[model samples]
Every structure is written in structure tokens, then in C-alpha cells.
Target chain A: MIKLAVPRGSIQKNVSEILADLSIDIPDYNRANRVYSYEFKNINDAIARSFAEKDIPIQVALGNYDLGIVTSWWADELLIKYPHLSIENLILFNDSVSKLYSTRSNDKLPLNDNLDEHIIVTEFPNITTDYLYANRTTNYRVFEAWGNPETWLNGDASIAILPEEKLTDNVKVIDSIYQGGLLLIGNKKNLKKIKESKLFKLLNEYKGLSSRSPFHFFDNKINDYVNNTKKIYSTRKQIRIAIPDGHAFRHTALALNNAGVEIKGYTDSEVIQGDLSNNVNMIINVMRPQDMPQAVSLGLYDIAITGRDWLKNFIYNYPTAPVFEMHDLKQSKYRIGAVVSKDLNVTNVNEAMEVWASQGIKKIRIASEYFGIADYFARNFIKSEYQIIPISGASEGFVPEDAEILVEGTETGATLEANNLEMKDLILESTNCIIGHKNLIDNVNPLIVDFINRFQ
Target chain B: MVDTLKKFQVIEQLFRDVLNANNFTEIRTNTVQPLNLYTSAGTLTPSMLHGTYSFLDWDGWSGERVVLRPDVTVPAAQWYLNNMEGQEAKLFYIEPVYRFIDDKNNREIWQCGTELIGISPETANEAIIKLVTELLGKLNLTTAIKVIITNKDNNLQVDNYDSLPDESIAKRLIKALGNIFDKHGFNYEFIDASQNKKFEYYTNYAFSVIANDTEILSGGRYDNLCEGLGGKKAYASGFAFNMNELIKLLSDEQ
Candidate 1:
């Protein structure tokens, strides 16, 4: 059975009208209705349910539905906010789409202003943050509001960001955060239900669809699903597993193959289309290892193969995040350690604190991509004042230029030495391992344990 | 937790007993099978293999891809094709079929189904429905159900764009399977599902026992499937009662 969430606001009428054209009808869908769902017929008919337009992306991403008729801008926002879900905009209802606009009291969204005093109210926080951060803008606290975000643009909140078409307030348009259309968006792993549905088949039946049609992502995935004749797993009950994209993907895939879990083309394909045993529905994908722990914790993925340092960094980052490492795959071994400028008079964190006291350094600046780890290490070890600076990458470039201390994971000290950096203290030794959510592990641990045993 | 496990055991045993009483011998097959067996059928229904617990079966990657058996029927068919070719087999199986719903939830579902191979068309259809009816009655579901029967001709004819459920032979067998089920005493509604249908495996007729907008039992006749897997051109029909769905029905009643 395919679960479909129909957008519930103004787009409701348009969607309902379009669905009517496709011969699928729903009654009292726009207004409140007592019925939770309506199905045209059993066995391949849609179980149409209603959800707010804003919530549809998350609902579909959570696998509550196979697909949703969500606006592209909201889909883009949720995609950014929850990157772990791998949400895809399958097809646009219309080629031309509306966009999210950043409207401010003044025409300028300052990149160099200390607007900690200012507030910004917007429905799309993640999109807005991405825009601000991309431009290196700072100091404006974001406040989330939906529908009439313009109403909150008076006192502390000087900026009102909303859908370009939705906003009628008197504010200057600064930028378009995202452009959108009514498209079919679904969780990548659970898309088989959508592909198998009459809805998808019906949508694809429209004219102008060609090999050159602008739907390579959806088309490729659909082709994969259609071609895999014997799917070993059923799409009805799903478990999406992720392998880290770089450095760890090959090792993880090898371990999975060794563990007797068959991921066809895991090590070869641009995208491996099917699962083991030849049937379908193993929702597995490759993602950056840095994103694995958070993705697993958020329930976006049931399990993931990630370096132990990433999990440690994530736990240090999100102390209350709901995830744990079930077993170590024992690959991609590395050590996260404290590294300092070669001129520092310290070989360890304790001595580094003493150096800070002797040199009368007021606050030690620790820079790392492992911000959480750096902060956690600072709280535990540094006796004097210290400020943890979060760096995106290039941990070696920071030491003497922007920071005095560096916390980073390294396999060899060649890069550190090349940059005139020396290891100060070892934080933890790490390896690639499988991590999963606390709530989800019980359901998938048996598979994980068995997969791990294949390596043994 | 203990209570749920006990309930699971009771439900499984109950299903096993029902299949046994119906003159069907239980068959056990491996949880894994060759990936090629499913694809060789050369049907659009191959998407059914979308998410198998598959891995390379040989060392360093060059090997037949294998998966934990997704559905018992295919493995059961391969078994019949290998061991009992040209022979009539009344087989029932109780096993767990794994499904990956997404990255989060996967079901290790216990499915109980019966396949009546080499049986006459009408006989196989009627017998399968009779068992399904009996099981529903046995379960004593608090909510009543509806069974919808859709003939395969109308099903395969609609949505010909995807060329499915069409075995390319004369009805081959099970031509009157729908007619036979129409005559059963149990109340059923017949619908023309030729447009936008989903029965990729059924050769002639498909039926679903639905309760509370959910399918409690469903199956179809795969007349040419045995032949596709190297068995004689025999008739086969079966249905599985999702134990979890059944328990959910009971739980809802409470």
C-alpha cells in the first residue's frame, strides 16, 4: 500500500484539481474532514492523507509516506535542515516555480554587522542560515514563524523572510533563498513504494517525457527499481543503511560484502540499483562519514558505517543525540589528537595550560573541524580561559594564524609536520564502525551482528 | 516483551496447524537465494527485488548475488522446479520475509502461505480462498472484512504500458479461476482493475481481504510462474495472512 500526503493549504485546491484530472478524487480534503484517508480501490490505489505543506517534506522524509505533493521551496528547506534524509524532488508539477525571498527593513542583509541585537523572523530558518553563512553574515538571531512572517517584522525583528509570492509586506527583497514548484518529493530509500504506485506511473505517462527530460535523478532511481527483478527485501517494511561516502566507503562496502550482506555495485556502480538475493528494497546509500552519526541519531538512517571519531565528535557535538555504535567494523583507523604550533612550549594539554600561565596568555584559541571535541577537551583539560573556534577544514592552516591549539584526526603526522605542527596530546584512537539510533537498533541489531560476523 | 513473544509463538503455531489440516506439507527453504533466479523470469515485476539482503556470493566480488529470501513463493518455486518437476505438490511454508520500509523500520514478517501446484485451475483458486476464509474465521477478528476479486485479464489489459501479468500463452490454466471464486458462498465483490493495477506476479485472478482500509489477506494465481522457473505448465495459487496485521487488528479491538 502506498501512503500519500496531499498538501493541505492553498495548494490543496490545485492538487485536488490536478488529481481529479488524473482520475484520483478526494472529498472535503481542503477543509477539515473526519476521515483520515481515502483510497480509490485496494491493491495499488493511493491511501491519500492530508498534511500541511510545510510538514509534508519531513513526513515523507520520515517514511510516513511514499511521496508527497510538497512545494519545492519547503522541500529544499527541509532537505538542508535534515540532510541525512536524502530527500529528492522527483518531478515538478510545473517547470516554472515560486521562490523563497529574504525581505529586510533596509535593502542590505549585512555581511559584516554585529546584529546580535537584531532579530530575523522567517519560515525557512535553515535556508536563511545557509544564505547568511554562505555570505559570512553574522549576529542576527533567527526566529521561526510561518505564514505572515511579515507581521513580526516590527521591533527587535527587522527582517521578514517568506515565500516570494506569499509575502505582501512592505520590505525590500534582498535575495531568493530557494525556487520551488509543486513536485513529488520522497525519501530516497523508500522511493520504491512511490515508483511502484499508480501515481508515479500515471505522472510519467504525460507527454514530453524523454531520455533528455529533466529528471535524471528520479529517472535513474526508477530505472534501478524497475530493473532489479528479484528484490530480497520488501519495500513495505524498510531499513535504510548508509555507508560513508569517502575514505570509509570502500572499506565499509568490503566489510559488508565480507559480512555476507550483498549490496550489488556497492563498490562499483555510480549507484547500485538492487539488494542481495535478487528481490528489492534495501534502502542503502553513501554519504559523508561526518554526517553519519547525526543522521543515524535523527532516525534518517537505521544504521551507518562511520569512523569512530565521527561518532565521538557527534556525541561531543550533540551530547543528548539519540544514537550509539553497535559494533566496530575495524577499518579506516585514525587518531584524534591535540596539535599545536611547533614553537609552543607544551607536549600535552596539562603542560599547555602551564604554558598559557607562564606566557600570560589570557585565552587559548583552539580551532578544529571537531568543534564539539575541541570544546569537550577544553572543558576537561584546559585550566585557563580558552575559546573553541570551529573550522570547516584545513585544521593545519589555523595553528599560529587564527588559533594556538588544534584538535584533529590524522592517520599520519606528515601533513602536520609539513605545516610545522606537532602533536601535543592524543585524544582518542578511532576506527570505522556501525552506528545506529537507540530506538532503531533493536530492530536492526540482528542484521548488524550477522553482518559483522561475516568479517570474522 | 515476553507476552509479545508468547503471542508470536501462539499465532505461528496456529497458522502452521491450519496449513497442516488442509493437507499441505510444510516446506523449509534457505533464507537466501540466487539473485539471477528472480531476474531470469524477465518480467517488469523485477522491482520486487528492490531491497534484498543481498551480497556478492563469491570472494572479491565476482559471484552470483544472493539475498535472504524475500518471499517464500519464489524459493518454493525454484525448489519445485529442481526437485519435483512435472509432479503435483501441495506445499505450505511459514517463514520470515524481510522488508526494508526505509532507513529506519524493517519488518521481519512471519508469512504463512500455501501453493497448490499441478492442480486444476478452479480447484486451486477455490481451495486457496477457502483456506483464507477459514483462517479469517479462525482468527476471530473483531472487525469484519471485505474480499475484492479482480480478474487477471482485465488487470493485465489495463496499463499495458508496463506489460505485466501477461504470460503470453492461452489462459494456459486458471482461465475460470475467477469464475470459480465468484461462486463461493463467502460474500465477495468483483471489480475491473485493468487500469493502474499492481499484481505483477498473478497470471489470472487476484483477491484481497481488507479490514479497516488495510489488506488482511491477499494473493493471486500464478499459472505460468511454475513454467517460468522450469516446472511443468502447472497451476499455482496462494495467499499469506500477515501475522502482525492480524495482531494489530486484535490490539485495536482492545
Candidate 2:
């Protein structure tokens, strides 16, 4: 299947025109209220998805899509990070004539001097990493942004790399990366057929499309890094703790409040990095509880607070993994259970199996983000083998349509009740708990242990 | 360093037993080879060369650099061309190949599969598909495997290894190969080579075996790879199972 991706925002209109000129049209290209993606009914057999400008390059690189149209800056950004991903630069469609340059408010940061004390903020961390490397400056901490680069110049940062067009009148250009524009990148997986196909060759010869490709070497002062030089972290005499973000944030805040540990800059902020007491260094960073198990076991974080259910799910798959559950905070309580339609008489695993067997369903479909939990549950409860269809969210919605049962983390059971799904098997109860690396308990300082004791 | 060697051994032995039944002799090639051979064969890229563990020629062979063989196919081709001399030969091998996977991780790959040299197109097609299917069956996969076949003639180009004149020969070969696939009752789908090409040296067909949405075994026909390497023109076909993938899948199943 031909899967193509286009950047959703900003450059959408320009690319829509370029695609139109090439006789490859996407429906509702110019409509302001148009949906994120469209499938062309024209002779071309393709499925196109509209992704965030930065995500387009990664989607194309991972071979999820055959082709992607993204800014050259993002393409260069991902290439610098993942050089081995098979992405071929097909042709440059349009030149936005925008150079990725660093801007300053009033005091322009010197290029050659020790940027050691300065804060370098950018939306493109990999590109900033390259810029710092090429300039031979390592004494700066890069502050990654979720949005608004200009707002950063007024605050903690002195320099921010934004597009020339996006820069404000108050911001002055200090340095520039190479000029980049719209680039057509093909996946390495699709290279075999797409690059060699005669039809693709004809499509590459589109009129009004600029022949100049921005993906090339630079001879100018904006030099490229010979190799990627990642900043080495100096060993600090501080403990690292990761607090779960998103749904678990409120519970985490409440738990910290009760424990008398001051974690500043968490509430009313999307900040990933925050500061905590000196007992725990680097403040308290936020990450998904789902990712906490692997991260803590890898010793990236000395301590983490996540759901015991999540840890249970991890141990279900990898029992020998090095994860130590230190304390159960009794926060963010939830139940891991299977839910089916309320209309059905099924109330338990054996009853669900009976219904599935009576219906002569050979392979029962179960949906869950926790595939290991679902698979283990299905295998143990049902004598017949079942197919576990993974879902990211809204596991209850799939119960009546795509799946017969949904194995989900049920909190309050309101959403399940609203969806007309009845709780079947109460798999396990879960709550936010303190976890540490079994092999790295010594790394946790005494102050951190005392703090955990208060919570227990 | 990988603890999955036991899993590799199980799959490798199954492949050994299957290929032995088909009268293909198991052979071992050198762990290291001349870097020039791969370059001369028009298969080596600068990136691949940079990834290879090559050094100053200590063997006193006129400063010719050597590397730990990046793939079993090249060494297999060189061996066939040197010994067989265009004679029909069927060989299978299970060995470690070194290549660039990424910057941070180890590049050593455990490759195990069959290599056919100086064989007819019809015979090679039947042998290659059967061997790959047999290996997949031996893995005892939880689900049925799907084979995505790239038509040999769909990507006719002026590549270094093209020995055929008209495209009609590739057409007939495709039909013959399709028949062989049909006879085995293999679940297969056709995709053009222009969409998903693997090796630079593949001139005819390339196919990948997928189960659980993961590509486990991949290989294709390199009809003129021997001739491109300055050997006598001979038809060759081979397939290799990434033994690590087999081990991972089997481990999860067990």
C-alpha cells in the first residue's frame, strides 16, 4: 500500500499547490477547517496522513509511510539524530527561503566565547546540539521547548534558533544554519520500488517545482558537525526521581504535599524538568508511568513513583528485571479489570469464555494497551487461544465493535459505566507507589529514604 | 555476549536438517575477507566500508585491506566462484556477520541460510522458497507466516549484474517461480521491487517472510553477482534468516 505523509500546519498551503501542479491532488488542501488527513480518490492508490511538521520526518524514517513532505530543517534534525534510518532525498519542491538562525533580544550571545553560563533554548534539540558542536561550545544547557521560542528570549534564555520568518522585529539574528525549504523524502523500505519505478521518475519531473535540493554540504560559515557530540553528564551528589506526568500528575502532587517535599514548577507548567529539595537532585522530572519501569530498571532514575499495577504488568512479562518497589503511597488508585457489554450476561472470565465458546468464536479478541497483561489473562482464563489487539486509549469503546473484551485500568469505573460496559474480572488493584532500582539502592541518599519513610 | 545463542542453535539445527534433506551440503566460510572483493562486486557502499572493522594489511598481500566479513553472501559467492568454477553447487551456512547496525549498539549479526550457485532459475526458485518456508515452520511460530514477493522483472534496470537481454525472460521466470510458490501452498503477496528493495546486488527476485508483522527472513536472487565480481556468469540465489529474530520470537513463544 502507498502511504504518504504531509506536514499538517504552516507549509500546508504551499505543498498543496506543489502537489496540485504535479497532478497529485489532496482533497480540501486549501480549506482552513479541513480535516488533518485526506485520501485522494484520483487514480493514485495512496493513503496519506497529516502529521505535525516535526513528526513527518520520523514517520517517514521509521517506514510507517512510503513518502513524506516536510521542512528540510526537520529532515536534517532527525538525520543528525538517526543517521542510519533509510531516507532518500527525492527532490526539493519549494524553497521557503527560511534559514534556521539564532536570534537574541538585545545582548547577542557571542559565538566563539564560553557559552558555558548561557541558556540555549530551541525547539530543535538535535540541531542545537549540532550548532553547539560546530561552534565548539559545551558550557551551555539546552532548554527544549514545547512552544513559543520568542517568549524564551525574554526569560531564561539569551539565544533561540527559530525560522527567519518566525522571528520578531525585536529579535536580532546572531547566526544562521543553512537555508531549508520543503523536501520530498522517501522511506528506505520503499526505496527499492519507488526510486526505480518509471512512474515515480515521471512524477519527479513536475513543473513549477524548484530543481535545487537543499540537502547538501555547506561551504559557508554555518559549518556542520564532523560527528555528533552529546553533552556528557557530570556525576552529581544528588538523587534523581521521576514523577509520572498526565493523569497521575494530580495524585503525585497530593502525595508530595503530604510527604512535606517541596517540588516547585510542576503545577500550571508543562515543564519536563523541575527542581526539588537538595536531597533529590535535578528537581523532579515528569515521564509516563508506563515508561518508568524500564527507565528505573536501566538506572536512569534512582527513584520513581508509578502505579503498582504497572509494575505488576512489567513483572508479568519480565520478572527478573531489576526494579525495587520501595513504598506504596496509596495514591492514584485504579483497578485492572476486563469489561464487556452490559447487555451480555457475562460477569467473569469463565462466563465470557462460555459466551465466546457458545458463539463458536475460535479466537476471542481482547483489547488493551497492556498487551502482556491481556495476553497472560486471556491465556490463563480461556482454554482457547485468543488474539490480543492493542489499543492506546478508550479500551472500553472497542469491546462491542473491534473486540469482545477490554482489559483496561479502570479508575472510578464511570467511563466504563457510561460506555455500557460491565466489569467482569477484577484482575488487580493498583495505586501510585515509590519504586527504586534493586541494584542501585545505594545510589539513593539517606535524605531520600527518610522522605519515603514519611510517605509510608 | 548475547545469551540467545541457544535459540540461534535450535533454529540453525532445524535449517541444517531441512537443507540436508534437500541435498544441500553445509559449509563454513572465512570469518574475514578482502575489502576489495565487496567493492569490486559493486555491492559495498562507503557507509558500509566505514562501518566495517578494517585495518592495515598485516598479511603482507601488497597492503590490501581486509575486514570481518559483513555478510555471508559475499564470502559464499567468492568461495563458489573460486572452487566450483561455474559448476552447480548448493551450500548452507550458519555464521556471525559483522556490519554497521547503528552507532551505539553492536553490529554483529547471526546469519543462517542457504546459498545456491550455478543453479537454473527454475530450480533455484523452488529450492529457495522451500528452504525459507521449511525454516519458518521449524521455528514453530504462533501464527501463519506471510511471504511478500518482489517480482524479478518489475525492476529491470541497467544494473551491473543484469545478464539478461530482453525483459521477456524475466517474465517467464516469474511465472515459473509463481508456480513453485503455488505448489508449496505458500501464502504469498507480490510487491514491485521499486517499492521495497533490500540488497544492491539483487537482479532478479527478492522476498521477505513476515510473521507477527516482523520481517524474520529476507533474501533474493543475485543471478549475476558472481559475474559482477569478475567471475564466470552464473545464476545464484540465496536466503538468510536473521537468527536473532528467530531466537527472540521463539523465546517469547516458549
Candidate 3:
């Protein structure tokens, strides 16, 4: 039996059209509330599943699926990090194309300074790391982000790897690394066996797609929309604080206002980056909560307001990192745990392991945004061979299909219930908290101390 | 299974007999070591560092990564600093070293190795070469040893090596090795280091004992390793026999 993995989200419609051309009909593929798995009605003894585009190469490399469709850049990212993964039969779709750009802050290009002195944030952490290592730029701290690379291009990140569309006038493009497009990849062993199969024949026939009009992201480029209009004057002793800009924004804004630690332009409706106080030493920047832990650990920021789950993940991955939680904001409470499909009748991790064992599953796949936590969970609870599938987001749809269990965080159990997944074990109960470096916590600026005191 | 185990025991016993007769003490380091021990500058090559099998420990909430012993040389230096610094010691180990060779999966190789620490450069180099040749001869395998000489000035290549300007450590090592090999009646050759440059943290000299183009053993002088591992400057040289390669060669002879 041949198993295929396809991508979901923005490129889903384009992939759907390709599947239609190949006469591979997968049901509910382009719908918002669609299940991840499906059967190929036209092909016998074949099935397909949907996953996040970044996750396709990983699934194929793990041999979980015999065939996969993913972007070439994602495949290259995986291959660059792990060159030994057996992914063969790569057929690039010429119509879909984008370029990854290494950009630098136009404001802070100190020519004599080393690359490690600059902060580089990217969604493609692996690719950025490979680029740095290839250039012999050691001693660097590259932080991972969920999305919105442009938002960090202003002050928080001095360098970034993003698409041309996400570029801003405030940054200069250094070099373009990978020119990527949608492509089909297959497991090395399985591809050899299926070369004479119908699926392989169909995919091989479409390899010469150079005649198709390329779908270029640069053609209809976005205007410079995410510019840092209000720049804080550079200061030697300025204290930088990173605040969350996504789900925790409103709660963080409320907590700041309650503490009377007010920035002029920061409110529930809008967040600001600049001096939070008229004082010269106080500076604030807005970025993803997930990037805060590493940023604080790297001393790029004096302190940051982020979720405890993110802090725990950073601590788990780098136990020697000097970042520690200074105070808990006591908002945006959630529980991070192992979630499995309720149909499996597994109330805990041990039960899930037993059921998987009975099914003759050798290596259980655990999906999570926090792989460190998932690895910790699998090692402690699941006494069996397991693999942690590091995903970007939308982890709720993983269980019972792409993954057997999900190490996820949920504010309420409603989302898990709606997705037919239940919390099998709670690993951590977390809330929004402030994190600071262990070395500088005692020597923080007085204004930052006032900000933390207000949360009390 | 029993035959394979017997062959392994025989090969190990041969190594122990040779090393023990040379007054080398046997010591085993931990199978797991902290990642930082190998990542400090000048400790490992970038390629070797990339091949380490590192993961967070159970109490890794504090952010330290532990690696399955990738190379015994670094840990040997670490072991010296931890236990017996500022002392002369001949240490040997029969331990497995884990590395990811062009793959993500852990590949464990059993290496029977020895290190001569806190000794002079020329003495340590000659002693190691003599010991390796003796071990090979005892195992009934006549081996050809290639001593790779690296000079700071890349332009220097000498047939005699003594007339090649400056009393550099490489020149001294070549003269010392030549004298020892001639006295011991050992088969050996001195080759240019640049021809097959695999100088990873080796300051002066390196050697490889090859049989039928397969490297059965290799090692070098790494004086910087001890200082890199937070110890004072100490001269050290070590070599490890690829136990698997030796066993294969032994079985083929049988």
C-alpha cells in the first residue's frame, strides 16, 4: 500500500488542483474544517494525508508516508540539517516559486562587527544556521519564530531570513539562499519499489513542468507596510523588554496598565516599540512570545513577557541557559499535556503506549510545537521508541492521523474536544510570565523593577 | 555468536597484553559526557562536532546537553584535568565511541586506545609509534606506518628533514621517529602532512597504520587539547586501533 502526504493551508488550493489533474481525488481537502486523512478513490490500495507544508519533508523522511508533496525550500531545510534522510524522486513544480532572502537591518550594519553581534530571527532556523555555519560565522544565537519575520526586521532582529514579500524598506537584502517551489518527494526505499506503479508513473510524467508560468512571490510584491516609523534613539545603557504581540497582547497590555507601567502608544488595540517611559534607559519591543526565551538568554533583551510554556521549552532544550522567570503575570493560563484521540480509549500516556504496542507500532510519532517538552514526555512516560515531529502550529489535527499523540498547550479543553482529542497527561500548568537573565536580574534598571512590582 | 565473541575477546586480550606490558594503565571514562567539553574552541573540528550524538539529560531543565562519548581523546584530557593534572601518565582504554557518520543514527565504534600525557613532544611521539607497531606485530599483522609531518611554513618539504631549517616540533618528531623505527626494525614512512591533510587539532604530527589501504589505527600529538579542556599546557599524544578493522584483518588471515 502506498501512503502519500500532502500540504495544508495557503498552498492547499493549488495542491488540490494538481491532485485533480492527476485524477487523485481526496475528499474535504480544501475545506476549513477538514480531517487530515483521506482515501484515493481512483487509485487502489492507496491513501493520502494532509499536513502543514513545513512538516511534509519530515513525514516523508521518517518513512511514515511512502510519498510526500512539499516545498523545495522545506525539503532543502530538512536535508541541510539532516543530510542522511532518504528522500528521493524530487519533482519540482515550476509554477510555484519563492526565494529565501538573508536580510540585514539598514540601521545597524556595523561593518567591522562579527555576525554573532547581530540578532537574526527566522521561521527557517535550520536554514539560517546552515548558512551561518557554511560562512564560518560561529558563536551565534539564532532564535526561531512562528511567523511575521518582517515584524522583527525593525529593532529586535538585526538580521533575518524571509521571503521578498515580507521585506521592508528599513532592511537590506544580503543574499538569496534557496529559490524554492512546490515539489514531490518520496522515501528512497519505497520510491524504488513503486517506480512501476501508477502513482510513480503519473508523478514522473509531470517532472518537465518548465513550460508552466512560474508563480513568483516577487512579481506582486507587497509595499513596505511593516516599517518601524517610530525609532528609539540608540543608547548604550538602554534596557530592552520584549512583549508578546499575538494572543497574549491584550492580557499583557492590561497587566501593564494595571501596574501603571504605561507606554504612550501601547494599548489593547495597538502595541508599541520604543521607550515605554520618557526615561532614556527604558526601551520596549514587540515580538513573538516563542522567541523571547532565547532572546533573553542571549542578552539581546533585558527581560521579556512570555508564556511559561515557552520558558519551559527553552529551559528544557538548553538546561544551562541563564534565563529564569522573574515574575508570573498570572494571566493567559493553560495546561500543556499529551493529547490523544478519545476513540483510542487511552486516558493516559501508559494506556496509549499499550494500545500502540498492541497495534504492532514500533516507533510512536508525537507531534508538538514544543519538541523539547514532547521529547521529555515521551522519554518519561512512553517507555518505547518514539519520534517527536516538530511542527509549526495546528497541532490539534495531528492525533489519530499524522501523529499518535500531541504534546500541546490548551487554555481550555474545548479545542481538543472539538478535534476529538483529549488530554491524556498534563505535563505543565502554565501562565503568562516575565523572564530575565540570571546574571542581570539583580542589576535590572529601576523602571523595569517598577514594571514587575505592578504585576504583584 | 560464540565464535564472534571469541574473536572479539582474542583481539581485546591482545591489545591489553601489549598496552599492559608497556606500563600503560587502563582507565575507563564515562559513556556520557557534557556537550560543552567537546565544543570549546580548538577542541574538535567543525565536522567532528557536527557528528556528535547529543541530547538533553533527564534533569536537562537547566539547558545542558550530554553526548554519548564521541571521541575518547578529548575526554582523556578531561579525565586528566579532573583527576591527575600536572602528572605523567600512560592511560589506555577499550571503549566504544559514538558518532553519526553521514547519518542521523548513532554509529558506535569500539576503539582500543592509549594516551601518553605530560611527556616531551619527541619522546611521546616516538613512544606511541613504537607501541602501535609492537601491538600490530604481536597480533600477527605486519603493518606499514605513515608518519605525517606538518610544518608551520607550508613551503618546506625535506627528504632528510633535519636540514630543513628551524628546530620545529615537526622536524624533531620526524628525526626521533626515524631513529626509533630504525632501531626497532619497524616498517615506517614519513609523509607530507598536506597530501592527506586530516589534521584535526593535531599540532605537530599524525600517523596512520594502513594494511591493504584500510586504516587499522591512527593518532597524533595534540598539545593544545589539555589547555582547551581547562588545564595547563601539557604535551599529549594518543592512538586508537579500530578494533573492528583489526578483527576483520585477523579473521581474513585465519
Task: Give each prediction's DockQ, rounded to 2 decimals.
Answer: 0.01, 0.02, 0.12
Clashes of each: 42, 8, 8
Candidate models: Cα lDDT each? 0.61, 0.66, 0.72
**Model 2, stretches more than 4 Å misplaced?**
A1-227, A230-233, A269-282, A441-444, B1-197, B200-254
Ranking under DockQ, best-scoring first? 3, 2, 1
Model 2, range B179-223, lDDT digits (tens) per residue? 554665555543333423335677766766666676778777888
lDDT of 1 by residue, A120-177 (tens): 5676766765554333332344544423455333222456676666555356665555
Off by over 4 Å in 1: A1-412, A416-456, B1-7, B42-47, B51-60, B102-106, B154-192, B195-199, B230-232, B250-254
Score every model by TM-score.
Answer: 0.39, 0.44, 0.74
**Which candidate number has the best TM-score?**
3
| Top candidate by DockQ | 3
Query: Which pairs of residues clash in candidate 3, taking residues 3 or more apart in a chain or in different chains?
Result: A95-A215, A318-B63, A319-B62, A319-B63, A319-B64, A320-B62, A320-B63, A320-B64
> Model 2 over residues A241-338: C-alpha lDDT tens digits?
77777756766866787777766654644634334443444446666677567556645567888888777777675666678788888766889988
Question: How high is the lDDT of residue B223 in model 3?
Answer: 84
lDDT of 1 at B248: 60
